[model samples]
Target: MIRLLLVDDQELFLQGLAMILESQEGLEVVGTALDGEQAIARTRELQPDVVLMDIRMPVLDGVSATAAIRRESPEPPPHVIVLTTIRHDEAVVDALRAGASGFLLKDARPEFLVQSIRAVVEGQQVIAPAETFDLLRAFAPVRPAPDASILAELTERERELFALAARGLSNADIARQLWVAETTVKTHMRAILTKLGVASRVQLIALAYEHRLIEV
Candidate 1:
């Protein structure tokens, strides 16, 4: 079962979302918090597997809370999915930079919300590639050209796979596109992560954008 914590200042929305999530199979609403401060306290207590965090809240906000949880928590920190009303808000980018696993628009379909939770838990990105590209293009800061030495670490095939990954292709999709086995894709991804020094696919994409590695 996926243990989840819901964080939002809106009491009604918090309770309502908890009810909906708890009713789904394989999900357990372990706790709820009204703000980021409370969310941090409950997280230390409950140690949930995932946190559905609101971007704005009283006392503390989701982005700060996510940073705290990720930086201070023990190994296997809970994955955070920021909830935002605005699709292209800069706060979404801040949240991701602060170590959130992903973000979902508050009005996202119930099925999509559930799928995002599962996807994040399974080490996959929830944000669509196109949307992520747009977000990066709009808000990501300019950086010096990507380090040639760093780029040299990846083989030509690995670079191709990394470019596809930055474009938001799933492992299965990448495998199909490259006419390789899913396991092969997974192996390549592992190597890519090690080479890039990134912990997740989302971070890899972010790094690619920050370094202007892909045109996106």
Candidate 2:
């Protein structure tokens, strides 16, 4: 079963979500926290596979909390899905930089939420297609330029993998497109992460953009 931790300031919403998630097969709401502090504490103790975190909270916000939790966790930190009302481009960029596995609207459908958790746990991203254009536009004014330097860090195959990742393609999608095994894609991704000095795919994209290695 996929273990989950819910962290949101809304008591009613947290409890309601816990109940709803618990009812779903192959998933379990392992714990709930009201703020970023409690969320970090519970995470240290529970070590859940995924954390459903709210962006705004009383003590600390989701972005800071995600960064803290990610730093404290062992390699391969637990996946974090930011549940927020804010869909602003800045917020999305900040959340991704903070190491969140995904940014999802608070009212996302239950099935989608569950799928996001599973996808993140499986080392795949789950960006909402509805927000893709908006996010891409956020970086449109100064679109990335061609940079041959990035190619030095990746092998030919790894470059192909990173290109797909730069385009926001999931591992499964990249695997199918390349006619390679998903495990191979994952291996290339790990090398990309190490060479690029980024912990998550979000940062990978951010770095790629900063270095003019990839265009949106």
Count of clashes, each model? 0, 0
The sequence of per-residue lDDT tens digits that candidate 1 reaches over residues 3-24 is 9999999999988899889999
lDDT of 2 by residue, 98-154 (tens): 788778888889898878788788777777533644564574333345666866967
Please give each candidate's TM-score. 0.91, 0.88
- What lDDT score is found at residue 88 in candidate 2? 66
Model 2 Cα displacement at 105 (Å)?
Answer: 0.4
Q: Report the lDDT of model 2 for residue 182.
A: 87
State each model's CA lDDT, in order: 0.89, 0.80
Look at candidate 1 and give me any clashing residue pairs.
Answer: none
Please give the lDDT score at residue 13 for candidate 2: 97
Off by over 4 Å in 1: 144-149, 152-157
Stretches > 4 Å off in candidate 2 = 129-133, 139-151
